[model samples]
Target: MNTFKTEIVKTKEQSKTLAIIVVVLFIIANLYIFLIEKENQNVYLKSISFVIYFLGLFFLFGQSFIKPKPIGFFEIADTSINLRLDESQDTLLFIELDNIILKYTGYGSWWTHSIYGNKNYLLIACKNGENYNLEILLRNRSMKNDFKAFLNTEALQEKFQLKKTKNTTCEF
Candidate 1:
C-alpha cells in the first residue's frame, strides 16, 4: 500500500556533504605536505595521506553508482511490484516477475557478504525487450527485509525460481 519515493532533496544534501568532506580532505593533504611537513618531510606518510586524498576523489566518482539513498520508487502491493524511476521516465509494473534476485556489486563483494553486511542490490531483471529491468538501491535494513519477504512469498514469488541458477523466462 505504501510507495517509496526518491527523496531528491536528501540526495542533494548528501552530495553536498560528500563534496565538503572531499574538499576538506584535499585541503588537509595540502596543508600536511606544505605546512606541517617542514621538519623531516616523511615521504612514506605523505604518500599514504596522498593515497587517502585520491581515494576521496575515487569515492566521489563511485558515489553515483553506489547511490547514497534509494534512487527509485518501489511499491509492493498485494499482488505485484511497481518500480518508478526519476532517471528514466518509465513505470515498470510486474504482475509476475521472472526473477527477483539479490545481487551484490562492488569490490570485495564477498567481504561485504561475510563481514560488513550484504551489499545487496534488489535486481528486478527480466528477459529481452521489456527492458524495464531495474536495480533498486536499498538503504534501510527494515525495508530490505520487507522487500525480501514480499518477493519471497506466495503471490509475486510464484514466478521466480529464487535459486542461484539463471532463469530466462519473463512472464510479467
Candidate 2:
C-alpha cells in the first residue's frame, strides 16, 4: 500500500502582481460602463458588476495572506483506492487521470490549456454536472506516477471495494 498526498501550489509574487493589475483594470472598466457611460444598466448587470468588484477587492487584499490548500490524497490497498480530501480542499467536480480531453501551451492560459507545451490535465466534472477542467499541475510527476500505480494495485481494490467509473481520465 502507498500513501499519496497532493497540495495546491501557491501563486508566485509575479502572479499576485498580475492579479492586482487585472483587478484594477476590471474596476476601471466597470466604472466606465456604469458611471461614465450612463448606459441603461439593469439590476442583473449591476449585481454582476458588484460581484466582480468584490472578487477583485478580495483578491487584492487577501493575496498576501491566503495560502493554497492541500486538495487531494490517495491510499491504495491491494484492490481498492481511497481518495481523501484535506480540510482545506476546495470542492472539485472530480479527480481522475483519464478525464483530460485537450491540450495546449501558453503563459497564464486557461485551466483547460496546459502551461507547458506538452503537459496535460484531467477534466473533472463540475458541481453543475458540466465538465470542469483542472490542470494536473503536479510539482513532482514521478511521485504522482508512483501513487497512481499503487492505486491500481489489485490488493487495494479488494480491501477498499473500490468502484470504477468509466467517465474519468488522466493525462500527463
Candidate 3:
C-alpha cells in the first residue's frame, strides 16, 4: 500500500502578499503612464487592462480561500511521491530521464529579478512535443544531492516510466 500526503506550496499569507504586489505593480505602471507620459489612451484599452489585471489578482487571492489539493500523486509500493503540480503526474506525460537534458550556468541579468538571487535550477527538459521545463531552485548542497538521487532512483524511473531514446530533438 502507498500512502501520500499533499501539501499546499503557498500559504494564505503568501497568496495575499503576491496579490498585493501584483496590484501595486499594476497601479504603479498605470500611474506612471497617466502622470509622466500624459498619453491620453483609449477608454477601451484602459478598461481591458484593468479587467485583465483584476482577473489575475482575483485568481491569486482566491487561492488562499480554497483548500490545497494534490495535482497528482505517484506511488511505488509503500512510498508516495505527491506531485504538487498536475504536469508531474505520469498520466499527463511519460517523462524519461534519458530524454531530459540538464544545464548548469551562471545566473544571467534577467535572473537577478527572480526571488532566488544567483541560485541554480535543475532544468528538466522533455523530448516529446511538449516542451515542459521543471526548474527546481537549489537551496543547499544536501537538497541538490537528494534531488539528483531521486531523479536517478529506480522508483522514480518506474513511476515516470523513464526510457532511453536516441533522438533528443523535440518538435513544437
Candidate 4:
C-alpha cells in the first residue's frame, strides 16, 4: 500500500484583481440603476443587473475569504484507492482499482489555465457513472511524476484496462 498527501493551491493575485474589478462594477451598476434608471422604470434591466452584480460579489467574497485546504489522505492499496477530500464526509472516495476507466492530464486549454493556474492535474473517471473532473492536486512535480509512474506500473495495468480515447466534447 502506498500513501500520499494532497495539496490545494490558494487563490492567486489574479483572483484578487478580479475581485476588485467586480466590486467596482457592482458599485457602478447599483449607482446607475438606483440614481438614473429609477425614472426610466427598466424593471428587467434592474433585476438582471442586480442578479449579475450580486453573483459577482459572492464570487469576490468566496475568493477573498475562503482558503483552500488539502485532503486528509490519499491511499493506493492493492485493490482500491481511497481519498478524503471533503471534511464533512468521512470518506470522500473509495474506488476499486478495476472501476477506474480513464486517467489523464486534463483541462489544458488556455481558458482553464487562465482560471486554474498552469499546473498539471490528474483526472480520474470511474465506471459507475462517476466523472471526477476536478484536478487532483499533488505536492510537487516529483510526486506527481511518481504517482503517474505508479499508475502505469504492471501491477495497476493488470488490474484494469485504460481507455484509448478521451471525450473531447465541450458543452456550453
Candidate 5:
C-alpha cells in the first residue's frame, strides 16, 4: 500500500486575492445591473445577488476555520481501493470504482486549488451507486500522479471510465 501525507499550501495570500477579486466583481455586477438594466430591473434577481454575495462572503471567511485533515492512507490493490482513516486501518470504504469524473477543471465540481492550496482530491462514483470523495493535502503533484496511475492499472481496467465537464480549472 502506498501512503501519502497531506500538505497545506499558503492560503492567506490566495484567500486575500480571492476576496479582493470577489468584492470587485460584486461591486461591478451591482453597478452594471442598476445603471444599465434599470428599465428591466427585477427585485428578485437583485435580492438573490445580494444573498449570494453575503453567503459567499460568509463561506469565504469560514474557510479560515475549517481546514481539511488527511486521516490515513489510500490502500490500493488489485480488487479494491481501501480507504483507511486514522491508525485503526480498518478500511473506511472498499471502493469498487466504476466511473471517475476526471475533472481537472471546474469550480464547485472538482479540482479546488484556489482556496485550499496543496489539497488534492478525487471524487469516485462506485458501481454500487455510492459517491466518495478523498481530499488530501499534499505538498506536490506526486500524489495526484500516483492516484491516476493506480486507476490506470489492469486490475481496475474495463470497469473504470473518465468523465469530463464544462467548468473552470478549480472550484472552491
Candidate 6:
C-alpha cells in the first residue's frame, strides 16, 4: 500500500556550472599573479596556481562532452513502478513488482554515491530476465528512510532480493 514519487535535481548541470565558475576565477588569479604581481614573484605558488587552473579547465571541458540526463518521474506502488522519463508519449514504462528478481540500492561509498542526490539509481532485475536502471530522487531524509523501509518490508523481501552496494552497475 506504500507509494513513492520522484523529484528532479540537476546535479550534473550544477557540477558543470561550478567547474566553469572555478575555471574563470582561476584564470583571473593566474593573470593577476603572472602579469600584475611580477615584482614579488613566487615560483612555487605560481606553478601550483597554473596546475590548478589547468585542472579546472579540464573538468569544465570534459563535462561539456557528456549529454545531460533527462528529467523523469518514478511512481513506486505496492504492485508496480511507473516510469515517465520524458514528456513524450514514447518514454512511458511500467514495471510490475511481482516480476522483480533483484533490487539494488546504493548505501555505501561516500565519494561514489550520495545518501541523498540525483545519483541514487535503482536497479531492478526481473524474473523474465530483463534489467532496468532508473535514477531515483529522494529529496529529504524522511523520504529516503521511508523508501528504504518499504523495499525492506516483509512482502517485498519475499518477492525479491534487496541489495545494498557501493554503486549500482547497469549494462544496457
Whole-model Cα lDDT of every candidate shown, in order: 0.51, 0.43, 0.40, 0.49, 0.52, 0.56
For candidate 6, the C-alpha RMSD (Å) to the true structure equals: 8.4
Expressed as tens digits, the lDDT of each residue in 35-82 for candidate 4 is 774778578878877886787767645443434344444555444566
Superposed model 3: Cα runs more than 4 Å off:
1-98, 105-118, 122-128, 154-172
- Judged by TM-score, which candidate is best? 6
Candidate 5 stretches greater than 4 Å from native: 1-67, 71-73, 85-96, 105-121, 136-139, 164-172
Instruction: Rank the candidate models, highest lDDT first.
Output: 6, 5, 1, 4, 2, 3
Q: Per-residue lDDT tens digits of candidate 3, residues 97-158?
A: 23444333222133232222122222333455444343333323343344455555554554
Please give the lDDT score for candidate 5: 0.52
Candidate 4 ranges with C-alpha deviation above 4 Å: 8-68, 71-73, 88-118, 158-172
Candidate 4 lDDT score at position 77: 47
Would you estimate the TM-scores of all the predictions? 0.44, 0.28, 0.29, 0.39, 0.42, 0.49
Better of 3 and 5 by lDDT: 5
The TM-score obtained by model 2 is: 0.28
Q: In model 5, what is the error at residue 48, expressed in angstroms?
A: 27
| TM-score of candidate 3 against the unseen true structure | 0.29
Scanning candidate 2 in windows of ten residues, the lowest lDDT window is: 104-113
Instruction: List ranges where model 2 is wrong by over 4 Å.
Output: 7-67, 86-137, 148-171
lDDT of 5 by residue, 8-108 (tens): 22233347777777777677556655675766767877776676567566655655454445456556554555666555553333345666544343222
**True lDDT of residue 94, candidate 5:** 36
Give lDDT: candidate 2, residue 149. Answer: 66
Q: Is candidate 4 or candidate 6 better by TM-score?
A: 6
Question: Can you write out model 1's per-residue Cα lDDT over 1-172, one digit (the tens) per residue?
Answer: 6444322112323477767887788778777777884577788879977886788767655444443444556566665555656665444445435566655332122223212222334556554445344444444455555556666667556555443223312111
Candidate 2 per-residue lDDT, tens place, 1-172, comes to: 4455443232334476777787786786579456854467666767767777777776655443443333454333443323444453333322322222323221222232222211224333333555534332343447546645654554332222222233323342
Task: Quote the positional error of residue 54 for candidate 5 in Å.
Answer: 18
User: How far does residue 50 in candidate 4 sit from its true spot (Å)?
Assistant: 34
